[model samples]
Target: MAETSITSPHIMQIVGYKNTGKSTLIAALTRSLTFAGRKVAVIKHDGHDHFEMDHEGTDSYSFAQAGADAVVVMSEKRTALIERQAIPLEDMIKYLSRYDWILIEGYKQAPYPKLVMVREEKDLSLMETLQDAVGIVSWLEHDKSESMKDSEGLVRHSVHEAEDIARWLVSLECHEEKRRL
Candidate 1:
C-alpha cells in the first residue's frame, strides 16, 4: 500500500488470547466497513516472532538486509517488504490517517479505543487494562441475529457474521459522531 500520513485518527484495537476470534472479528469488521463505503486501515501486532521480511529471496528483502531503511518490492501480482526500525503505534496511526478508521488487531495492551474479543470469563480482565473499549465480540452463547443485550458498558456482537459486525461499527461511528457534536 502507498504510504500516507494521518492525524488525530480514531483507532479500535481488537485484543484477546489466542483463538478467541480476534482475527475473525477484525476481518468481519473490515468487510463490513468496506461495504459501508467507509475506508478502513488495519494494523496487526505480531507477538509470536520478530518481524520477518516477506518474500525471503526477493530483491526487497535483499535491499533491507543491506541496510536500506525503506524498500518497496513490487511484482506484477503484488508488493511487500521487510523494514528496519520499530515504528510506534502513533506513527502507524499517523500513516493511516487518510482512512476513515483504523482497526488494529492484537494490541491488547495498547491504549486505544477497542473492540475486544473475550471467549471465556477469565479473559474479561483484559478490559481493565485497555484504555477505552467501545465494544466486544464474543463467540459465546448469545442471540446471533442481533446485538447482544448483556454488554454492560459497551456494545457486543457475535463474530460469526461480517455484516453484523459492520453494522455495529457503523453504529459506533454514529454514536461517536453524536458525542463529538
Candidate 2:
C-alpha cells in the first residue's frame, strides 16, 4: 500500500476496530494536550456510508435539502462548515497544519505514526500488519504477556492511563521534532 503523505509537522493517529475506544482516547488526549498549552485539532473518519450532522427540521438541514453544496454557520464562539463532498485525508491534514498537533481518529491504512488500540489478545495481530505503529494502548489486563510478542519493541500503555499516554505522546513528538532539526 502507498503511504499517505502527511503535511503537518506534528500529527498522530489513534486507530482500531469498532468498540476499541479510539474516540475516547482521542478525547482524553485532546483535553490533556490543550491543558498543556498546545493548540490541537482533530479529524475523524466516519466509516458509515451516510451520516447526518444536522437534524431534519434544522435550517442547515433544510438548506442541504435545497441543494446547497456547502453550509457555513458561525457565531462569536464557534463556526461550523458542512460541505457536501468527500475530502481526502491529506487535504484535511494540510488544512489543519497550523495547529500544534493534529490527532486523527481513523484512516488506519495511512502511514502516519499511530498508536494501535488492542482490546484483546486477538487484536495483537494488528501489530504485525500495520506500518508506523509507535505504540499500543491495551485494554487487556496482562499486556506484557508472551502473547504481546508482536508489540515487543513498541511502548505499551494501559487504556485507562490517558494522562500518561498523553505525556508519552508529547515526548515522542518532541523527540521527533529534534531529530528533524
lDDT values, one for every candidate? 0.72, 0.83
Give me the displacement of residue 96 in model 2, in angstroms: 0.6
RMSD list, candidates in order: 5.0, 5.1
lDDT of 1 by residue, 50-116 (tens): 6675557877767777888888767899766455767888888887778877989976767887877
lDDT of 2 at 60: 92
* Cα-lDDT of candidate 1: 0.72
Model 1 regions more than 4 Å off: 1-9, 74-81, 143-151
Let me know the TM-score candidate 2 reaches against the reference structure: 0.90
Clashing pairs in 1: 6-94, 6-97
- Number of the top-ranking candidate, with TM-score as the measure: 2
Candidate 2 per-residue C-alpha lDDT over 1-181 given as tens digits, one digit per residue, 9 for 90 to 100: 2112234458889998889999999999999988877788999989984877888989999999999999999999999899999989999888887787889998889989999998877788777778999888989887355676544578888899999988887777657655666
